[model samples]
Target: MSEVIWWKRGVIYQIYPRSYQDSNGDGIGDLNGIASRLDYLAGLGVDAIWISPFYPSPMADFGYDISDYCDVDPIFGTLQDFDRLVERAHGLGLKVILDFVPNHSSDQHPWFRESRSSRSNPKRDWYIWRDPAPDGGLPNNWVSNFGGSAWEFDASTGQYYYHAFLKEQPDLNWRNPEVREAMHEALRFWMRYGVDGFRVDVMWHLMKDEAFRDDPPNPGYREGWPDVQRVLQVNSADRPEVHEVVRGLRRVLDEFPDRVLIGEIYLPIERLVTYYGEDLSGAHLPFNFQLINAQWNAPTLASLIAEYEAALPPGGWPNWVLGNHDQKRIAARVGEEQARVAGMLLLTLRGTPTMYYGDELGIGAVTIPPDAVQDPWEKNEPGLGFNRDPQRTPMQWCPGEQAGFSSTKPWLPLSDHFREANVETLSKDPRSILSLYRALIAFRVQRPALRLGDLRLLPCGERVLAYERRLGDDRITVALNLSSEGQVVELSSRESHRVILSTYLDRQTEVATATVTLRPNEGIIIAA
Candidate 1:
């Protein structure tokens, strides 16, 4: 195994810092809080931690709207605090990956402030700005991901600026050479600070169509869907020029050794694969969210996996994500019972797996009260269920006050079952979802086949998804039952295999016959 293949074979744990832990008791998680918990993460067996943005910001987008590219947000802590956290993480053998929000900057950022000051400002072209239509309407029909027009009219400059998300986050112009150099310099700054890698945010939105054409109407638009969904986003995002920008970012990472670049792209498999760049020089991992978006049924997931595997560019590595801060918890999307199955699926897949902070404990989304809603999306588009607060609530560490996430009340409500579903409570139970996650991660680490093997889909019943991972003589077969009822899967080989781990966490060392019986919402890993 290559020493630098840690990213390829290791699990990446994502930390939404504000909800992870609060050391100062300010009801918000900070860098010191995360550093204090490094041992806990090391015990969980993830090889790396990908923390969400903690850059200096106005908090309009909860740290995603970066104001200062090189400084830590006061709410998160100072530069020294981040350095200590990275040092502690490295000491524990954990890689540190920071969120790189290169597509846009907080409207309050100095760059944007200067760019919007006047049409002839030196930084005027740093962001996407255009004159209004002949009738003084929006620059184009582009819609913001949050809501309404993507173009935010600037009264002072008599021009409109584009923001794919909140107006507070003005989109940067990657088309500008100076803008690209600045973002690249920001990346290099972090890289020099001992950061292992970066999870680039809205990477596909870095470049827009130069023609400024209006996006076509979405044929599948529905009334209750987000306003942004009304358009196909053809001209506004995922433009062909984005690949060159991605390659440029890759070149910056190449300046540092053993550093990975993972792009958060929401495009389809075909378009997503393109971000890998020619000869796979773009993102080391263009996050494969098919598992997050696909139907949980066995056939749907089976086909989706096959399609994604086939769509990868030559030598392009694959990665999987079941849940994230922006989406509903995996346990909430699928029932609690199936969350274990999901964990097994995520850890056993044939590539790097990114685990959301609280999913290992089978933590589901909390119900956020109207008064407690913090997500800008939910506030901007009320009653449309665009709320992410439910999923972005504080992590349930224990059953104590604030679920041990903070001494004070958490910024958002905790799940009703936090008392029963927290790590302190679940870690003691061998059959708990948390235990299953640990065992699966350990099993993956110990087995080369599970980590770097070629995958082959196995023949199985409609309700059972089965596959084999083989690297030389090390062979492991994974069978998952996706339904409420039990499932029976037949192995191609009649040789007896030892069950290494199961979602139920009760089948280790058990010998499985050629025919395997999987309990409801159960998945198993067997070694030959």
Candidate 2:
């Protein structure tokens, strides 16, 4: 692999536009708001920014339900605003990747409206629609990710349409050759507009079972929660044909120089590798989400790290994600005490690193009042207590009105800890988690070993985690304290390891041997 395409080793900051910033007084974030924050992103040392869907939508799935693939929603801004955002981001040495939701479109989309008008319409086959059984029941028992049946009855067509998520988001029929061509055309439109690449939304759900057989029951089911037991199989996704779709998309992207494709696949490490394609031609990165779901302990985390490094196919790149719009923030999950260590682990890992907005500021989840909840998932399951609105609140730029997110009231509440976690406060504090994240990202950019390196785990006890990243002659060793109490890490190699970076409370100058002391949750990167 030529090192020319530096994005391969780059860090991508994901900005959920609705929660990032709001330059307009509409409460919703706009492209201009993103343009205003370019300097902050560039200063964080990220190579690119992956902005989540801002396409024309009915807000059914909060931009995931695209009503128009080619245009920006009025809520976000005009087409000109998007172009300016692309230009400004490029000027700041940051590549821009757009979220491409190719699998489905909002039911209100013009194409879907036309398709459902009549069976003989030219766009009739654009979406998957099948007739129900003689009993008037669904074709199968496939459950939607958001709960309930995956099929929705269309009164106009007298047939059921497939929807893996919300009923309003109808699945596109990849079986239709014309539909595939149209999706490719959408890709071409963006590529011509100077967009670097695409972060495909629900990439594995592009296809469904041809026979539409009922899924088998899950073994993890319990008697108390009938809804939990009903989630037997995600039959609508992970079809065998999904790979061919990815390969075809990759070929289209190959037409443009330095263009890349990334897939959002939440499968295990073994299956996730296949999305990269058989000959290193499919997705440039298939979003390794181990860190997002793994247990945050020394033994479990170490084992997961080793498994991921081993599972990646030869020559295929690996990507790490700590949090996204769907899940809770890491600071809230692992506790604020371990936030710095988590950031170090994320930035130092091989391959690309993607940081969710507000993650660098050590921002935890906020409390969204019941009346303020906008997530359809929580709205549907009343008192279920599973709400994502807390993590999706607007970013805190300052401690002032609206947390400096906007002049008007925000769509959601700000974290009570905003005063302590806001960027304004942490940017000046050297020992803050925000500072540690910046230092780690800067160190990663300057070191090639950490960018494209082979990972090797060193002998360390339960409380101390140690590893070495090596690329050719450059090698960097890292040791982290995983416990609340300090631990002494006695490196097997007694050779002196020059300290390159550290978040330790004590600024120790020298250590004759490889052995070093680490304060609780303290981490150090050394060049051996």
Candidate 3:
């Protein structure tokens, strides 16, 4: 078989700029800090790095509220610094995927300022603004993702602007040709650097209902749930017109070769697959977050993976996301033992795998102090279980104060387990989480079947999730015991096999039978 695209064949490591590393002893992380860790990341065996938004912002929603689309924020670093980091990343044979936020811009943005200056401004149409309803209320019943009404009343302009998130992030009018053109140009600005591609932020929110209609109530919504779920969201997000916008973005992305477009879309498998476009022309990969919400069990995970595999469009490629910046870490959700199993499952699966920063070290969420809380979701709702600060803590680099992430106090607190669970400490231990990740990544690189193969589920008991990856004659079977009790798994191929690697890292025995026993919570990969 011929070689496939880099993204399709290797793992993508996500770096949250503010928490990755700090070079100048400032409490906040900077661009130079990220540049300083290139060697460490390269050693981690990731094919590419996807950095979250580091653009100029007002700190309302962290960097998600972009004030400038063309430049990096000073807290992170200068454009030249970013350029240098990209150069270094490429030199180390690593690709860079920047976070492109298109749904909204910071309220302080020049376009937004001018758009809100007056109703007759030339750029007024760049953002979505509407007259109050007949009773001088919000134009519609849409709700914001961060908890209030989606429309913010502007006392100065006597008009209301729409914001899917914080009011500071005014939604752009994608229906406006000029807005689309400007956003496309933003994509071009990054492309000029010959970077890999973009991970478009809130891809599903790019388009909204054209008629300014009210969203119906959701049957699934409970009175105490987040207000965003109170409505069906039919008119607020995931509109059919989003496909056209994705196609338009795809056209610009296709102008450059081997550059991928990964849309940050959160939808069911059926709707999620459509982002691949009718001809797979939309996003190169629409991040599959099924695992994030799936129950951590053998039968449940097996069904989720198979369902996602079967839902892909004709030429669509699959990608798996175990953890991300928005949600809790894999270790925090599924336990440390299972995080190792998750690493194995993610790497050996049929699609691309993205590892959240510090996940390889089994980093879980840290408790944020009430006074140190920064997430707007937490601030807005207070106790609605919407805070994201716990997952955005500083990385544990070494066994030192501040975890060697910064010389000064970090912007957010570090986990108490930093001393015990850090790169410097784990790199020396054979059975460490970091070691297992490196081994799994290296093994996947050398074995073509594991990287690119067809998946076949094996017959197993309730406690085991088993499957085989086959690429011609080279076939490898994987059996994972999700429960604490041991279980016997029956393999379809009754051939002689050798254990390539195990979670325990000490079980490399040979097998020549159709059935095998997995020790409690153990996962193994066997080659025949």
The superposed Cα distance between candidate 2 and the true structure at residue 219, in angstroms, equals 1.5
Residue pairs in steric clash, candidate 2?
none
Query: What does candidate 2's lDDT look like per residue over 1-528, in tens digits?
Result: 346486778889999999888988988888999999999899888989999999999998899999999999999999899999999988988999999999999999999999999989999889988899879899888877776788899887799988888899999999899999999999999988899999999898898888887887787776544253465555567888889999999999999999889999988788889998888878999988888878877888889888988888888888899999888899888878787788888888777888998988888868788789999877766566557888888888887888888999888888998877888888878877777777888878777788888888886889777889998998988887878999888876878877767774336345537577788888888776
Tell me the whole-model lDDT of each prediction, alpha carbons only: 0.91, 0.85, 0.90
For model 1, where is the 10-residue window of minimal lDDT?
1-10
What TM-score, over all chains together, does every model reach? Answer: 0.99, 0.96, 0.98
Predicted candidate 3 versus true structure: per-residue lDDT over 105-160, tens digit per residue: 99999999999999999999999999999999999999999898999999999999
Task: Identify the leading candidate in terms of lDDT.
Answer: 1
Worst 10 residues of 3 by lDDT: 506-515
Error of model 2, residue 31, in angstroms: 0.4
How close to the true structure is residue 406 of candidate 1, measured as C-alpha lDDT?
93
Compared with the true structure, what per-residue lDDT tens digits does model 1 show for residues 1-528?
Answer: 656379998999999999999999999999999998899999999999999999999999999998999999899899999999988899999999999999999999998889988999999999989999999898789999999888888999999999999999999988899999998999999999999999999898888999899999999999999999999998999998899999999999999999999999998999998988988879999998998878888899989999999998778888999999899989889989999889989988889999999999888868888899899999999999889998888888898888999989888889999999898999999889888888888888788898999999987979998899999999988999999998888877788888878888777888877787889888998887
